[model samples]
Target: MISKQYDTIIVGAGLVGLATAYQLLKRRPSERVLVLEKEASVATHQSGHNSGVIHSGIYYKPGSLKAKNCIQGYMELIRFADEYDIAYELCGKLIVAISEEEVPALNNIYNRGIENDLKGLKLLTKDEIHDYEPHAAGIAAIHVPQTGIVDYPGMANKLAELICQSGAEIAFSEAVLGINEATSTTNVETEKHSYSATHVVTCAGLQSDRVASLTDRGNDLRIIPFRGEYYQLKPDREHLVRNLIYPVPDPKFPFLGVHFTRMINGGVEAGPNAVLAFKREGYRFSNVNVNDMVDTFSWPGFWKVVGKYGKTGMGEIYRSLSKAAFTRALQKLMPEIQESDLVSGGAGVRAQACDRDGNLIDDFNIVRKGNVVHVRNAPSPAATSALSIGQYITDQLFVN
Candidate 1:
């Protein structure tokens, strides 16, 4: 039987929300916890469609939420995989610098890794680079042994299974329409039914900003969706990439440049250049949503981002449209790669947060408004840091 109120209600059944529910139920097994998801199943958006890279805290600033969570979550994720018999590998990765100009940025990344307390980080010479990846060509590279890959969607499904086994209800295909915060309880109204809870935690991914605004109308933050398109290497060409290979990212932008990733299931994936999406959930160039486009155009931060990174953005657009352009970018690290070696693959939309001032919010932005907690911004390492982020949110709920 459904109760009028639950001890806690979590919105969004992505990895973060599911992790939060799992931790909460683990702490208080008898507490009535319920999870609500707009999609018919969990991990349908960002969590399900990510690159599946277990980040090594190399790019994040020390002490930032991203850095801390990624480091702690990396350990927790490996441990959980071990206990649950999930398939994951510490295959490691190489952040290659093809030119002398890129060496400074590469050094900065190494320093960040050191500051973030990562062990077994090595600086590889041009000759030594081939030791790990024979096809990779670079002037210098940072070999991060902690970097790895896994089947994230598989992990998420297992989490959902565990959540149900632990006696929690996960209602899917129930889109959240509004949130009404009262003195003692919060009411979450969906398309089909309504749920009331003492406290509500929303980890809505793509619709995070909009869902958050349902409760607090004064929010200045908006979600700007960016589509990342990927390409998979033909089976015969998979050997060109051993483990994972990445370029030293530009310091000015938040995106990691195109490279190669050896998936846990087999085969290699390459090239995910970031581009503006026409829809909030837009996966392809043709998949356009008028309202989503209008929202993006009306946002001040969106234009500011376009103006600031226009050149880079245009380059990304070019790469997205031209297979040759994307292959050329990948060739920086692996010169052996040819255009014919690539084939169309899946794409994912990132729910990037931007402020009213036209600034893209970088860190993990979680805000607590009364009894409602909102995860305003969580990108790249979010999937890798879900457990830690969940634990952090779980801690906040205990104090309340």
Candidate 2:
């Protein structure tokens, strides 16, 4: 029996889901909204596991959804943080091109930043690079003044509290197993109970494809989990990184290469190399799920990705296995950084979507069918773009 009917039912309690819920209630305070999370607490997955760097919208292509949302969301996020009294720092970040070969990509990123209407974006000379990061070594760099850091978990928890205060319900540990759409309403089935909703919005990160399939089975997109392994700098060595120091990423790869970020909670993080994960939630080499592995392996898109980027993929595996290899990548930016200065930190699994032809989606991908809307692909800048993405999704799904 359906226990109750909500005006809207949101799956996943990650930042995107929470932000969407908050926006929905802000627009319609009287609406009955229910947010269901499979985890015991909010922001338990991608939202909490991230590096906590507030993206600057510098890397995204102009006129893309990512660019528009990230630019607007960056401002919105700062406003929300100020209003809610969240601690954050606009400490800025440096995107360094260590070699001549990387200079072109760095220039392209700069051009994109200009096109995206970023203010105070400065191209730094080799000598100027050290002015921002005293020890950083690079042939060229871009100083993005808008980049910052914040406690996303703290922000998410606060948003959840506000959502609760708005009279919406957040049901923890309620894994939505199925969604059935009828003529009049959509029935969402969780492990313990079934509920109906006028509309359902799913921001399921790792399980996005599977959850979306429950509503629209014909979707060709699939989520391929890539585990990003990180290492924290020893307390004594934290001084090495003054702020966020990022390498000029390869255009071919969708993920930004391993770099350094100073966490809001203190300490520094380095080297989150993207390696294919056996399970959707796999955080370690040994944490494998047979079904998830088989599901990933069975996908033609997965094989296409492996076949095309086999060498790069193998390199990521090598970095994962060898701390020395990971350190060497970091050393390219900071020659003084040694493996001993690094200690094992946490890992975050990115739910990247791939098409049937094996093309990794480069931007946010969302799909809608009947009363159910699915956020199939949202990664990296997603945390930074949460509020804007929420507004967009809310407009698409709810706003007349």
Candidate 3:
């Protein structure tokens, strides 16, 4: 039976979904909006699982969604955090290069930052780099003072709170099982019941492509799950990192390889190297779902994409198995970081969209038609850009 009718139904109660709901209610105060979450609570997935680094729009191609949205969203996020008193610190971050070969790309990022309207971006030398983080060692580095850390889960919860207060309902433990476009409205079916709405917006993180597939358009681009693993510093080693420390990312891949980041609450989190997750939400090396593994391997698009980037795939898989290899990658940036300085941390899976031609869609991918809007692909920095993306999605769906 249809549970209830709503003006809008948003699938996934992650930050993006909640923010979209909040933004929806902002303009249409009396609109009946319902938010659905597979989990029992908000941010149980990527939003809660990430390292909580607030990005500064670095590394994104200029004029792209990530560039524009991340830059714009960072400011908006900081303001929102301030208004709500969410624990956050603009402690700044550094993007460093250990070799002379990496210096060119490092400068490219610096220039990109300037073009993106990011301020206080400085090229730092060895001694100057030590002034902020004593343990960090870089031959040349780009210092971005705007990047910071936040409590993402806390922020997600607050967004949910404000959502409920604005008269929107968040229905948790409700997995979206189906999507049906009825005459005038779209019906989203959950495990429990059916829900009808005037418009439907989906922001499922790990399951984004699967959700979109049910709607018809997302089938062209399939979601490939890549798990990012982190390691937290022991209590004694918390003081080693004052802010965020990152590598000058390989322009070819989607993730920023294992870096050190300081969380809003306390302590430091290191790593988060991108590896293909055996399960869609696989946290541990032992956690494997056979069907999920078979499903991913079964996709022809996945094989095509993997075949095109076999070398990169080999490195990620190798690093995933060998801690020493992973440590070796880390030592390239900070030579002093011993493998023992790290301990296992939770993992977050990214829903990467792959096209039929084996190309990875780096930009934010959104499709809107009729009464439904699908977020086909929203990778890294989506959290930072949630508010703006939310508004963007709403405008696309209703505002034309």
Which candidate should be chosen as best, given TM-score against the real structure?
2
Clashing pairs in 1: 301-358
Off by over 4 Å in 3: none
The residue-by-residue lDDT of candidate 2 on 300-384, one tens digit each, is: 9999998888889899999999999999999999999999999999999999999989999989987778888899999889999
Instruction: List candidate 2 segments past 4 Å from native.
Output: none
Best candidate according to lDDT: 2
Poorest lDDT segment (10 consecutive residues) of candidate 2 = 391-400
Q: Tell me the spans in candidate 1 whose CA falls farther than 4 Å from its real position.
A: 1-3
* The 10-residue segment with the lowest total lDDT in model 1: 1-10
For all predicted structures, in order, the TM-scores are: 0.98, 0.99, 0.96
Give the TM-score comparing model 2 with the true structure, all chains together: 0.99
Candidate 1 per-residue C-alpha lDDT over 1-400 given as tens digits, one digit per residue, 9 for 90 to 100: 1336798999999999999998888888988888999899999999998988898889998989999999999998998899898889998999999999999999999998999999999999999999999999998999999999988898899899998998899999999998998898999999888889988999999999999999989888999999999999999999888899999888778788888988888888997899999998889989999999898999888888888888999999999999999999988888889999999998999999999887888899988888889998999899999999989998888684
Which model, 2 or 3, shows the larger TM-score? Answer: 2
lDDT of each: 0.91, 0.94, 0.85
Predictions ranked by TM-score, top down? 2, 1, 3
RMSD list, candidates in order = 1.3, 0.9, 1.5
